[model samples]
Target: MTNKNRNYKPKIGVIGLKGFPAFGGSARAGENMMFYLKDEFHFVVFNTNTHTSRKTGTYNGIEQIVYPKFFIGALNTFYYYLRSTLHCLWDGSFDVIHVFHVDAAFIIPLLRLRYRVVSGHRARPQFAAKWSWLVRQYFRFMEWLFFKMPADVITSVSRPVAELFQTRTKRKILFIPNGIVFDEKSEILQIEEKDYVLFASGRIIASKGVHLMLEALVKIGYTGRVLIIGNRSHSPEYAKELDEISKSLNIRFIDLIKDKQLLMAYLKNAGLFVFPSYHEGMSNMLLEAASARVPLICSDIPENKQVFNDDETFFFETGNSTDLAKKIEQVLSNRPLAVEVAQKAYERLKREYNWKILAEQYSKIYWRLIETKKPLNSGDSEIQGNDEYKAG
Candidate 1:
C-alpha cells in the first residue's frame, strides 16, 4: 500500500500470486480479479524473476515487476514479497497492496504501517495433508502471525474460513467466494459425454485425494478412460503410489493444464468431475466444473460444501473410497439425475458466484479504502462483510 493523493488511477501493489500466467487457484484468482477491475485501478504485480524472462511485461494492461528471488526456487515468497514491499515503500506510489495467502503475507504487520493492506485468508494450510508434521507446524505459526497482524481487510473464498477468522479477531473478514467466467464458446472434445472421468489439481499431492479416487475406480473395476490432470512434482512417493494403484485401471495421468480454455474443453467433455480434496479454502477447478455444467463428485469437506449442496453436487464421505465408488457409479448410471444436478449447480454458480459481480464488490472495497484509510473494527464487521463494506 502507498499514498494515493494524486489525481490519477489508483494503483494497487499485488503480492502472493506467483506472477501472471496464473496456473494455480491463488494465481488464477488474482489474475481474474485484476482483469475484471482493470478499468478502475492500475495494478503492479510483483513476480519472481523466474516467472518470465522479460524483466518487465504487461498482462491486460497490468504492469509486472519480476523481482529477483534468493536461493533459486526456495523461499521465493519471502524474498519476492520482502523485495516488493521495499520497492513499494521506496517508490511510495501504490494506494493498496493485496496479498493472497497467509504464507505469503507474514509481512502484513510491516506493510500495514504505510498502506491499506488487504490480506486474503484463503485456507487453513496448516491442516494440509501433504505436509509433514514439521511443515504443518510451520504453517500453523504463519497462520498465527497472519491473524494477529493488523490488516485493513481480510477476504476469504469460503464462508467457513471467514467465520473462523472472525471468531479469532475483531478485524473485518469478508466471505467473498471464488467465481468463474463461463466460456460460452463450445469446446467439444472428441469424447463421449459419459466416456471418461476428469480430475484436475495444480499439483498432484496427497491432500488432493487422487489416490483415493484411483482406489475407488479400482474397487468398481472401471474400464473407461480416467483423466488425472496435474504435475507430480509435489510428492513423488505419493504419485508412485497412485501409479501403482492406477495400473490395473484405465487411468491416464495428464500433466497440469495451464491454459484455462483447454482445461474447460476437458471438463465439458468429461463423464464426471471428481474433487476429493481434503483441504481447500475454495477451488478454481470446482468452480470451473460447475460452469462447464458437469456433474461433480466432491468429498464431504466444509470447503467444498460451501460451493454446492448434496442435491446440486454428489458428495461422498471424506476419505471413504467405498462411498466415493458408490457415488461415481450412481452418477454414471443415472444420466438424467447427473444432468439435473449439473444444470442446477451451473445456475447457482451464475446467480451467486458471478466473477463480474464479485470483482465489482472487491473494487468497491478498494474505493472505500481509497476514500478513508483506516482499520475496520468489530462494530462494522457485519455491515462490512457484505457488499457495502465501508472499510477496506
Candidate 2:
C-alpha cells in the first residue's frame, strides 16, 4: 500500500477480459483509469487475450507478461482467466490489483494480506439467465467465491449494480460513471440538414434490438435512410435478418464502421440516435451519441436515464416497437425541441462523462483503499464458509 501524495508512484495492475485497443465500455474505462492516474501510479495492464506463453514484455513503460493458452476450443474463456490469474499471483510486485469481472476474482483471497480491489462489471442474475440452469448456478457459486475474497474496495458503473453489491456485501461501494472521450468535431450538435431520422450502433444482434429499431422506422413512415453501423462479428445471421428486414421495409443499413472518426461523422449528421437495447450496464453508444450532439431516442432503462437528461432524451418502453416508433415520430415533429435537447445533453456529457475526470476519481479511490484497509468484523472470519452468504 502507498500514499497518494508519496514521491514514488505506486505500481498498479489492471486486469481485463479484452486486450489493448480496449473494446466496449469496460476496456475503455480501464484504459482511461490507468492513463489518467499514470502521473501518481505506474499502470501495468494485463491483456487477458494475450495471456499465452511465459514471455514478459513492456507496454508504454508498464510490465506485461504473456501467458500461454491452456485450452484451444470451447473452454477458451475459462483458460483465459486461469492463465491470467496464475500470472498475476506469481508476480507479486503490484501494489493494487483491479479486475473487471468476478470470473477469476476469487484469486484475491490468497492475497488477502495484500492490497486488492475487484469490480463487479456484470455479476447479475439477469445477465446469468443467458446460460442454462446448471451453468447459471455455477456462475452464482463463482460470484459468491469472489465476494468472499479479501478486497479493499469495490466499484460498479451504475447505481443498480452498486445496490446489487451493497445488498450482498458490507463493503463500501462506489458509483463511477463510465469514462468517455467524445470527438471534438462531433461534440457539438450542428443542425445538420438531413431527411433521414434513424441511427443505431454496436453489433447487429437480436438482443441489441436493431430489428425493433427497423420496425419502428417502418412505423414512423420514414421513407428515408436508416444507418446501422457496427461490428458484424457477434451475429452474422442476425445481421442478415436485419438486412432482409431493412430491404423489406425499404430502409438502408450500413454493415460496419471501420473508422471511429468516420462513424462519429455519420452520427453528427444524423437526425437522431436510437438505442433500443433490452438491457445494459451503461451504454457507450448512447454516450457517443450525446457527445456527437445527436438527439437520442433510447429504451427507457435506468441505465440510459443515468447518463442522459430525463427531459433531454426521449425514452421508449423497453422492447416495444410501437413505443419506440411513437417516440421517433414525436422527436421528428419537433425539430427545434429535439435540437435544444441534443445541445443540453452534449453539454451534460462534456461536464460529467469525460474519461480524464473519471480516471482521476478512480486513481483517488485506489490510493485511499491501499493506504487504509477496510475494517473487518471479528466474527466475519468464518463468514466466508457460510452457504447462505452465496451470491444470487
Candidate 3:
C-alpha cells in the first residue's frame, strides 16, 4: 500500500441494508454518510435486489452493486451480508469495509484482505421484545461474537452503547452520534383544527414503546389527532394490537413514509413530538424533531438523555404510560414552556447534531484508522484528529 496524499480518496465498501430505498435508522445513517462524504471518498453501497425499474446503477455519485434477491427475514439479511462480503473480498477494491450493524459483524473475520474493517453497533438487539426466544438467543450470541471479531474500528451512536462496549470488551470505541438535516424548500403539511397534536415516528416494534404512547394518550383523554408514521412489518401482531387500541383514540397510523419533505412537514406542524422508546442507539426521529423545533417529550432513557437535557426536553419514565401521560399533559397545557423547550432543542441541534459536523467527525475516524494501518514515513502528513477520541 502506497502513502495516500490529500487527493487520494479512499474507496469504502458499505455492507449493510437489504438494498436501496431501504428503511429504518441504520439505512438512513448509511445514506446520509454517503451523501455528506461522497465528494471526499469513493463509496460503493451493496444492495440485495435491484430488479425494480427504479433500481439504478448509482445513488448520487456512489456506485451500487446489486446481488440476487433473497427471501424476506433474518435469513435474507445474513445472505445479503455473506454475499456482499464475498464480492468485496474477491474484487479487492475497497480501502475500508464499513459494516453498518451488529448482525453483519460476524462476517468481518472472514474478510481476509488488506482492507480495514469498521462496524457499527446500533443497539442491544437481544433486548428487543419482538424477537422470539430463539431469535433473541441468536442475537445475544452475535452480540458476544461481535466484540470478539477482528475489526480495526468499532463505533456506537450513543454514549451508553459506547460505554457498554468499552466496559465489556476493554476496547476503545468511537462515539459518533446520529444527526439530522432539514429541507428548507419542503412544503409544510397543515395540521387541521386541533388544540394539540402529538407525533411520533420509528419502526413500530415492541421495544419502541408505541403501546406505551397509546396508553398514555388514552389515560390523558387527549382530544387532538395523533400521528404515528413507521413500518409495521417487524411486529405485525403488536401493530394489530395498536390498531385495535387506536380505533376509538383518534390515532392515525401511517406506514413508513418515503418522502423526507412530508415527514419534515409532520414534524414542523406538530404541537408536540413524543419518543417513548425503551431503548435506542440514538434516535434519528428525536434529532429530526429537535431540528424542526418541535416541543419534545421523550422517555428518560440514556440514549435520549444523551441528546437532550432536562431544559431542552421533557422526560417521562420509560414504559410508564401514566408518567408519559402526565408529561404530555404538562407540555400541552403550558405553551410558553413548550416554546422555550423547542427553541433550546433547535439550538442544541444546530450546535451539535448537524449532518455536516457529524460527517467531518466520521471523516476523522476513517482517516485515523487508515493512517494506523499504513507504515509511518517521515514525509507523511499526520491526520488532524478531534477530541471525540477522548472517551468520557
Using all chains and alpha carbons, the TM-scores for the candidates as numbered come to: 0.93, 0.82, 0.89
lDDT of 1 at 135: 77
Estimate the Cα RMSD of every predicted model relative to the unseen true structure: 3.3, 6.4, 4.0
lDDT of 1 by residue, 1-392 (tens): 23234457889998887666877888888888887888778999888866645577776789988876688676776788788878888888889988888886578887877899888877787877677898788888888787787588877888877777777877777878778865467555554344588899889888899988999999999999899999898788988999899998877888988777778778878889999998888998899988889899999999999889987999999999999999999998999999999999998898877777678767766877877786666567423444443243
Number of the top TM-score candidate: 1
| CA shift of 43, model 1, Å | 0.6
In model 2, the runs with Cα more than 4 Å from the true position are 1-4, 48-71, 110-115, 122-138, 144-150, 182-202, 250-259, 375-392
Model 1 per-residue lDDT at 200: 92
Ranking of models by lDDT = 1, 3, 2
What would the per-residue lDDT of candidate 3 be over residues 240-274, giving only the tens digit for each residue? 88988777687777787766666776777788888
Please report the TM-score between candidate 2 and the true structure: 0.82
Q: Per the 3 Å backbone cut-off, how many clashing residue pairs does candidate 1 have?
A: 0
Weakest lDDT window of 10 consecutive positions for candidate 3: 383-392
What's the lDDT of the predicted structure labeled candidate 3? 0.76
Each model's backbone clash number: 0, 5, 0
Off by over 4 Å in 1: 1-7, 52-54, 183-194, 381-383, 386-392
